[model samples]
Target: MAEKEWGRLPEPPREVVLRVKRYDPERGRTWWQEYRVPTYRGMTVLDALLWVKENADPSLSMRYSCRMGVCGSCGVVVNGVPRLACQTQIAAVASRENPVVTVEPLHNHPVVRDLVTDFTAFFEKHRRIIPHIVRRDMREVEEAEYEFLMTPDEHLSIYQYSLCIMCGLCYSACPVAASDPEYLGPQALAQAYRFIVDVRDEGYDRRIAIVDTEHGCHRCHFAATCSAVCPKDVDPAAAIQRLRRIVFLRRLGLWRKRKVAPLAGPLEKPLRRIRAEYPRHNLVEGADPERQAREPVDIDFREEWLRE
Candidate 1:
């Protein structure tokens, strides 16, 4: 099979140096390898990496899928910033005169090899937020059901967040994630807000209970880097801020979960369902009653949830 052309041939390709950070778990070693790669007018970082892997070194490793930006698989640190390699043009990071494109694995993630970072923990944090719609009628969810109707205005409200590809770029650029390993990170928190505000979703009480804790949305220090580095232009920092306000209001007994959006039906209107509640555990499980009483579990939210 013929090799596919990488980028536009508007201009002649130039020789650019690609300085890649390499790691070998088998040898437990880390090093840098520089390769001179041919670049074109619209050649991307991923294109250069492919060229290197095919021509210069077959052992060179990196992750990429769907040369387009949809899959979010080619996330890497391009000269100290988390970016989608497929979306980043080579001209943006390198020049013919000073031609050097430094590539490395994302920060705050465990490196698997050369440029691949382990997403096990990152995905685990995402799963803990319960990134799915929660409706009271388990039967409706499990069995066949009518579509949940939503207006254009309602759809537009949460449309931006729906664009998240779970690329982990926000999590990699998050300063809070760098400091606290337990922090839920921006991607998860943004996704939490996405489902919370989604008119079709009814998972507010259940999700809020999970993200209202210290290691959850509260850990975000509002660095805004997560928003800055997002390839899809999703503002996770803004979502975190809004989530914080909602959490505060819920604690102060000022806000309540809104009713679920209506289902498409000509016979009857969708019934309002009671919010699903989950307990917030402040004390360690199996701790002595005396120790639980003596120790101060400093939870920021009030015990208003306990009253219900």
Candidate 2:
């Protein structure tokens, strides 16, 4: 008995323009170059690029491995937003009027070639955070049988943050890094929070102190670009806010008191006034809050001490 046949798959539409940023070390110049590619039905931006590189121009250079977003190798600035080319659909972004998707290397990093950037600084910052578990005490021989146990609630607290794929999108989109390169940036700061909030880590206080510095959590301005462009929905901005709250509470000894400041102007106004008057009344510097609260702190001494 013969079975009835279903309809065949439809052919992909003919051509799409790939506008790429081209740079050659030998030539010492960079320019945009366009290539018209014969794209398939489910073709992605990465596929189109590969097609152009293989057939149209062998000199063209780009980075890719799995042809998937997992490797984070093909992340580039597409139309001003950092996205993985493999995950971006060509049909959706390419247009006849615009008909060209501008592809450039990831920002805030040294460009190696046409689409690849040097990731040494990015990974170096990650390494500086010391992302690891620190055990408090040696477990006894019998106690060693049980691994560190975490509650469901505790796991839920940091579960979203642990999903970071380190695609460098957050780093590229970060305005803080552009203005102040010393700032730790979102991905690294979020990872710091991941460890600081973990119940199993013994060095939570140390980690908090690490992030409380000028280049750490305090540098974040609460801009939500890191959260918005994150492909995995890991809200680094929210994590940073949590870390800032933790730092603020720790400085004020409110963590033990279990009290959070009200959202109204009572607390914020005084703090802002003190900040304006003192300019250098960071809690870490042993600034006397009572003195500052009573009268404006001397900024000259604070600045001299900070320089020291």
Candidate 3:
């Protein structure tokens, strides 16, 4: 059989159909508009929107600045998920065959235009937490003379929670924000926990007091969706749990007060027997026999194996 020669094939251009939710202040009714764009290989959703604004329609309004994820300005609901448009690729998110991308303004906020949502309420809640390091004392000293050194473990403990960019994605996704305007939401409560857990912070009691009420930490139902959708991986759910512990401990008078109460006659008999049989030394050494055996075996094995 004779081999047939194949001709060069043309490159497949990227394209996607975007359903944008548009609203104008002048026009009270909000409507959806569809636009198809020839997408590039590495084109982002923000790029597609910008292309539509420049080439297709000039009046299309959207908010974007850095064109990167850091700015937290280009956040919009993409396919019901709160995402930063600049960071999401159209090819990755949009269906290849259908390619119908739904773009809408973030929920729980007033829509400004096509993709811009007002962040006044978001900032107001953020500012209410006083997201700044409250010093224990204002005593001034030389940098060399006075230094607060922290352990590596201590620094890393709070490092993950410190990555929040205030993007308001979690705030928009929160159900509490929709029902109650003064709920303080996840972001604010997460920030409250950041300061509350700081060992150097003296305002732990004050910060806890702010969020201990009905509209605060107590309001969280432990849905854990806030942590799941967080771009920075700041587990606001864990912070809420820690806050609960703090609140419980505070209410129980476990913070500084120690209460001495006599044990019941029946309880005291068993406890005395346990204390007499185990003793302080035996308790300190631990009750795990396997663990004790493994320690000596591990030392012998390491010495023998290395020598061999």
Tell me how candidate 1 scores on lDDT. Answer: 0.84
TM-score of each: 0.81, 0.75, 0.75
Candidate 1: list runs displaced more than 4 Å. 1-13, 266-308
**Stretch of 10 with least lDDT, candidate 1:** 1-10
lDDT ranking from best to worst? 1, 2, 3
Cα lDDT for residue 264, candidate 3: 21
Per-residue CA lDDT of candidate 2, range 1-308, in tens? Answer: 01122133334446777789988887788999999898777777899888988899988898888886777788888888888889777665665555677889988877888998887888877877778766555342234544565668878988998988888889988999878877888999999888778776666777787889999999889888988878778899999998889889999987632222121222222211213355454466667777866875433233334456
lDDT per residue, candidate 1, 1-308, as tens digits? 01123343234238788899999999999999999998777888999999999999999899999999899889999988899999888877775566788999999999999999999999998999888877877555666367788889888878898899988999999998998999999999999998988887877888999999989988889999999998887899999999999888999999876657777754343333333333346746775666545554543332444355
All models: lDDT?
0.84, 0.77, 0.74
In angstroms, how far off is 168's CA in candidate 3? 0.6
Which consecutive 10 residues in model 2 have the weakest lDDT in total? 257-266
Q: State which candidate has the highest TM-score.
A: 1
Which one is best on lDDT? Answer: 1
Which of 1 and 2 is ahead in lDDT?
A: 1
Show the colliding residue pairs in model 2.
95-99
Write the residue-wise lDDT of candidate 3 on 1-308 in tens digits: 01122132222246788899999878876999999988876778899999999999898899989997887888888888888888777765665666888999988888877788899988887787767655446341222234444566766767878888887888788887778877888888988888776654556767777888888888888887778778778888888888788788888888631221121222222221111122334455447655654544312223334456
